[model samples]
Target: MKMDYVSSGIGKTDFLQLRKLYPLFVFSRVSWENRLDHLYIEYEFWTGKNSRNALFFRPSLKVYGRPIEKGSAEWLDPFLFQLGLIELISYWKATCSPEILIQAGSLAASQIKWWQKLYLKGLGEFFFRNGIERDYPGILHIECDSAKQFRPVEIFSLQGNLIPVGGGKDSFLTLEWMKEEKENNLCFLLNPIKAQWDTLRYFSYPLDQVIVVERQIDSLLLGLNKKGFLNGHTPFSALLAFLGTMLMALYKIKNYVASQESSANHPTVPSESINHQYSKSYEFERDFQKFLADSLCPSFSYFSLLRPLSEIQIARLISEIPGALSVFQSCNKNRHCGGWCGHCAKCLFSFLIFRPFVEAQKISGIFGSDLLEKQSLFSLFLSLCGKAEQRPFECLGTEEESLAAASLLWHKAKATGKKPPVLIEKLFSQYPHLLMTRNAIQATYDLVNTEHSLPKKFLSLLQKNVIKKALFDD
Candidate 1:
């Protein structure tokens, strides 16, 4: 299962070495079948002539509630093939092969271009972290020689919505806003963690109403990462988008509702195109909608319900919903631990945003400690507030949002006649000019970015929820 021959930490030299060693990576084939409890999907990949270089990945979706009638292969093959295409990114990163031969299914020239863009932008963080310099036209070459072109399914009328939940504050707010439509909504979780399950329970959504996808990454890829082939962040949300399409078709759901906010549009590295949240950006959302309309099912709808709002607004809204706030968890580092890690950027950002609205003691309790008080997080705070050279490679709000949140917290602490946290004091002392005015902070809380794909009904629901919470002064 492990390759001991692979070298470790050669940087760009290693990248060049891997590509030279493994010139061509092939998507050999894909196979799937419906078992008694779940739909099993598998993909085979290999590089070079040695059979020892082959890699296999198997990811499954657990079938719950009603038994899914197996649709025709013609109707199902495209979805499964597309899923494999996205799933291959994990394995492909191990050795940045120059050419990818797709023998499993054929893709049109335009489809090939789409996948290329996804891979390039999706792997932006990967390339930057590994210090690999790659240009668009010269980076990768994807060729599909398979003569079989899977036909797109024309869906007539699919009802209700499929909401993907990650047990985060954004999705938690989305679930609360859609509570009236609970019966019509099908909640989805990929590899559910304890926090995710607890979030559903808090919302009173039973298991039968949830779609659980159990994805297993091949151990070979992990082994390669340890051997230092090449590894970093991939566009996981992109994979989720493809998987969402499959779920919609199988369950006959009309809309694919996600919880990505407008803040995701900001690039992690300023003055460049590299974004850690590229897949969740509005650009990706817009392109995906068009891809669905032109290439895939035209009737299906996909959009993030919270796209219009900023992270500050989401935090403020969640502060109003006490029960939902109690169960939500956003710390990626501590996701498996079912609590905040209190050290990562995600934890610090969550704490900074919620501190202005939630009671100080309660916020501290939720995160297990006051994150701003930790001197160890000062560097992360600077990066988040635009003081550092680059932002932390995480899904975070824009620099302006971070400053606004910090300003609000600082002003609140001053108003309450309490000592400000260590990080807050350091931030203000170092960069007093970055402090936001009251009017500016209020505008951020009330503002809504117009670049979203939400239909009128979804927009109406979002506005209604904002009004109901009454977080802002009207």
Candidate 2:
């Protein structure tokens, strides 16, 4: 009998049923080989003991402009093993199995707790969306059968910075800030897309200087998703953290500079911790740094370069860099199409953030239309402003930031003696109290959250280029 899982929706019953059917998910093995110019990795998993149905995934990475050296297996093995641990989450969510058996490597009690916290918090949105209530200390159990414990390697002689580019304004700004030392920095990209490449080209970075990792999902997992098995968002940035660490070790890079912003800390669901961008949050940044220091090399610096700035600040900075305005993109839905869809929450939020800084004509030209005039995106607008039940489950700024951007645009329109757009008019008419004053909006631009992991050198760089010049000078 074919189950109508979609119509019924996956709930506690479905969660329990799948767990009972597939009692155990095993992290069976991790194998990697350094080929001529690329390093190939394969991970194996099983639904249950003695089950013939096994899953295999192959993800390869290449570091150009350098020789491929198979680093010490002692350190490399653990890195690959940990990478498998994160990769398994995508497949494990299919059944939400009660226990995960680790046969490939071992973890200490503290390490087990660390992973549990990561999985639970990382999958918080997944549980909330599926209407599944998971309790702590018993939500998911991890058992390690192997006797081997991987220790941190004493690594030295690593130099240069590695920046992960996402083809967005944030990364573009990072590239701009690091332009002085661009030769020492390498752009890291996973599953290269046209937008990512476009951002690199706009920055005048050659392809040979980029580190590209090609990740492939197992077909069986997709088949399960199609068969109506439970599935939702996984912690992708968490996977990137591990993969970035592997590349750092493989290439002897000192820094893994990401472009995640402070706004990622806000939860999608207000008053709850179910953030779609949990892996990109500052909490994760701090936790991952500690884990790396404890389990890997302490000197391997991993931090977001734009951690201290807000989305509005990033947008303001990008607005000043006119060259990036055309090449960089943030709309996830329309990136492959090479333009803004202008309908999704991401597109709408981006438009709102940039509206105050860029001229109306230029904004319209970039997005192909005035997103503010689109009445269809009103609900998303309300959600982003915190008027709706929850913010759209996307990487967006806080509700206050959205309100500030909208308010700033509103005041600008009124001062210019021009009428506000449809959405803007609707916003003030319906919720007048939501409007913010110009001074209040400017406060967001000047504000800098003190909580960040940026080292002194990078912090000084941010202060000089962004804080002192970009935000205040304007």
Candidate 3:
């Protein structure tokens, strides 16, 4: 928990040491350093930690040997370190037998850790052999901060704060909150393969000021004989802040903010993400916020602007906010296509939660179309119904909210006399696990009033109610 850089130089700040400790690193660099802003961020990685030697599943990793610069060393260093984990672990599974990687944080992170070895092994086999590569490249190209391509973090930090932007409802909500809160120290992120920038022109013009985390990590896997799918839901929230710390310290920024929702604090699915929201929960905001203060910077503070809200709550808020919707991005299947691949959980959940507020034109723009087919909605339905190793907790929503959205969609479907969402139909036909989820969602959601958004503070207060609902529902 406590790391002393001087005594544990190699343990705390040595890149070469970490690389040697883990090893599969092939390439690395500082992709964007906005000198004017004093933000320096490195795009780097780590080797395999081999925590799975005792199990049949092994996770291989790939990452850069450095950091990406957006602000200062204070802001950039830990940000890069955090980025390295998410970037490398994808390759880690591709190279090893790490099916269901427990990323120590993230919804998926929590679920995988609790699953049996047999389940993990099964997922590993299905993934590496099949290699289901999915990426939502809708936000990577927005113009970067107004500075040279490779500005140092020392400079970027002085320019502003590094904000790890998410292309989703949560972030869209945070942007408005932060803007309304009058915090100008902001820097945005554009991940590898995202198209959020092209769409930004549809909304605000100031987006060019955002700092991008251009990732080319896929190049490293070019020669590896093995392959595994990329894992999602790691503690990228905290990681980005650590990076902000490094870059800000090196360059001079003093604060960082993330868009993590308050609901993230509870398990993604009860018993699934229980203790691990720290990877993305408000718990991380609280803990890491203090960690940064005690061990690191006194002036530097890291917390989620959306920490008090739930994913559903944020989605609802984003619907009410105007320009924010135009620039937001969070689809995994199609980033460049200018449409939400209704199948991915992000699109599915967003469409469902906001169905009550946003109109067809607005919804169409969000997903690239007004027409959400039954199949798209069903994909999410199936996930929540329990199709894979984990349910789409992000999609599951609070019981009351979940039921509310389900009811709206349900009513709309019945009125049109359309077939039930695939998963629902399957359950009606007596599908095993499939039926259980349908019944659960129907019963569980009945009490949720999934209508309208709540103030961030109010949403936080409702978390206890959500937990009670999640546990009591079944």
lDDT of residue 6 for candidate 2: 51
TM-score of each: 0.94, 0.94, 0.55
* Per-residue C-alpha lDDT of model 1 across residues 393-425, encoded as one tens digit per residue: 998999899998988777777877987888988
- What is residue 282's positional error in candidate 1, in angstroms? 0.4
lDDT for position 362 in model 2: 91
Better of 1 and 3 by TM-score: 1
For model 2, the stretches where C-alpha displacement exceeds 4 angstroms are 1-4, 7-13, 52-65, 69-74, 468-474
Residues 237-275, candidate 2: write the lDDT tens digits: 999999989888877889999999999998887566688
Worst 10 residues of 1 by lDDT: 1-10
Give candidate 2's TM-score: 0.94
